[model samples]
Target chain A: MKLEILAALNAEREARRAAVLVTEIATGKQRLVREADLASDPLAETLAERLRMGKSGMAETPAGDVFLTVQAPPVRIVVTGAVHISQALAPMARLLGHDLTIVDPRTAFATPERFPDAPVHAEWPDDVLPKLGVDRYTAFVALTHDPKIDDPGLIHALRSRCFYIGALGSRKTHAKRVERLTAAGFTDKDIARIHAPIGLPIGAISPAEIALSIMGEITAALRLKPASAAQAAA
Target chain B: MLATDNDIMNRAEAWRREGKGVAIATVVETWGSAPRPVGSHLVIDDDGNFLGSVSGGCVEGAVVTEAVDVITSGAPKMLEFGVADETAWKVGLSCGGRIRVYVERVD
Candidate 1:
């Protein structure tokens, strides 16, 4: 590993860009492949598969045996409400190594005392989501149950490439939400991305159980294959 | 203070920039119930000082010693550790797992 290569890898991480450090095990030859360059690399297909899986391991290439250190950006959880579920979720998200942020316009709800482990923002989602830079690595959850707050955040999340978007609501509430979003010009296809009636069907009763179900769903969305994840979520 | 993978890499780059001979050991492969997953890192300096863990503190001491040698020789080495009884004299995982570690110098 050259000093320059290590420095470059660190720089890519700081910039929150995905990259892989390819090291040939036999000779110690190494190279850094940024996500943008994956298409042109000779090992493009294999690298893309590994990147999608977000796992680092030994790869047997026709050229040689190599190790790929896949550096996908850490997943960030952006919740639109600092309610009871968020309070229970903040700690769990930290335990799972995901960055969790709580946003709510209600000062009483978004108190530091309530969410000691997470950053509590006493602001609206529309005002904060942009600055948070919710990207492909983000899991956006609308838990406020307030259309004024959750609707704007949903719009932002839909426009961005956030991997997971869930909303806390029942089927009836989601129907209303769908109507509003449709009136707002979001096609049914774009609106379909949201996991309304949020969380997996675990028959959750309490707020903490609800949080666990939501977290479980998010983990499935992240780790499972797309087809499997859809099946699990369904 | 739990060190993330990024923190280990950052520390490795920082140590090298500070003019210290540094080596990084990574768990490249794992079989069975290995304590740490593949791609886990442990960065060491010439002085045998290390940060991070390739195997939940089970074989880090051995890795650090080899990493110091790799730093001095500038040649990467592949190291394997298995069950304690299999590696009678060597440090091994109590969890009955096998792991392959790659130790390389940062030049």
Candidate 2:
């Protein structure tokens, strides 16, 4: 790859945009295909599939064998609560190679000492999330159990393309929350996007176990087929 | 600090900007239980300094050594490591997985 191509690829990554580096094995000819240009590319369908999978592999075309380096944006986890569950989820998210941030309006809960690894924002989610720019690669989790904090964050997430939106609550609690969102003008289809009682059903009692379950659900939402991911989330 | 793939690529660009001969090796294909994924990268400088892993330390020494040569030659090379290859015994993946690494110099 040329230095210019490498520089451009790095720029795209810095901007958190997805791109593919296509390199021909035989000739070493290469080009960087930005996500915006995919629709017109010759390998649009294949590239789109690889980009969705976020995997790099070899593809055989009439030109010969080419390697597609699918550079998807790094997954980001934005938790609305810096509570016990968020504490447990922080390191796990980091271990799984996901960027994690803790947002809590309550200063006592959101503290740097509490979250040594992840960034803790002691501000309202509405004030912080817009700056974070939660994109499709982001996993938005509402764990505050406080509608005042989590509701606004959920509204932002619903407006954005974040892949996963999970809210930690009981079935009864979610039912009430659903009513509130419905009154807020969200239809059943839009409100259905949230994975209520957040996390996979694993009979988790401890906060750490709950964190594990949440991570599992997020992984399923990210890696599994969309239809199966919805079932898994359910 | 653990260096992510993004960090590795950024370091490669920084090394090039410093006028150091840099070569980047990427795992293009893998079979069986390969330690690293296909998109994993290992960036090396002319002095054999490298960051990141193509095989989680199993074949990095070989990849780094070959990367130095690619930096000097300015030509790309495809390296394969597996239980089936003779060199696997020297720098083989203990997990018995096959991986194809493409090493190219950054001009």
Can you give the lDDT of residue B75 in candidate 1? 94
**Model 1 Cα lDDT, one tens digit per residue, A1-234:** 999999999899778789999999888999999999999999999898887778899999998899999998877899999899999999898877688999999998989999988998899888999999987788999998999999999999988878889999999999999999999999988898899899999999999999999999999888675433322332
* Clashing residue pairs in candidate 2 (N, C-alpha, C atoms within 3 angstroms): none
**For this target, which candidate reaches the highest DockQ against the unseen true structure?**
2
Over the stretch B18-102, how does candidate 1's per-residue lDDT look in tens digits? 9999999999999999999999899999988889999999999999989988998999999999988863577999999999999
DockQ metric for all predictions: 0.60, 0.70
DockQ of 2: 0.70
lDDT of each: 0.90, 0.91
The true-versus-predicted C-alpha distance at residue A90 of model 2, in Å, is: 2.6
lDDT, candidate 2, at A44: 94
Report, for all candidates in order, the number of backbone clashes.
Answer: 0, 0
DockQ of 1: 0.60
* RMSD value for candidate 2: 3.2
Highest lDDT: which candidate?
2
| Candidate 2 residue lDDT tens string, A185-233 | 9989888889998999999999999999999999989877543333233
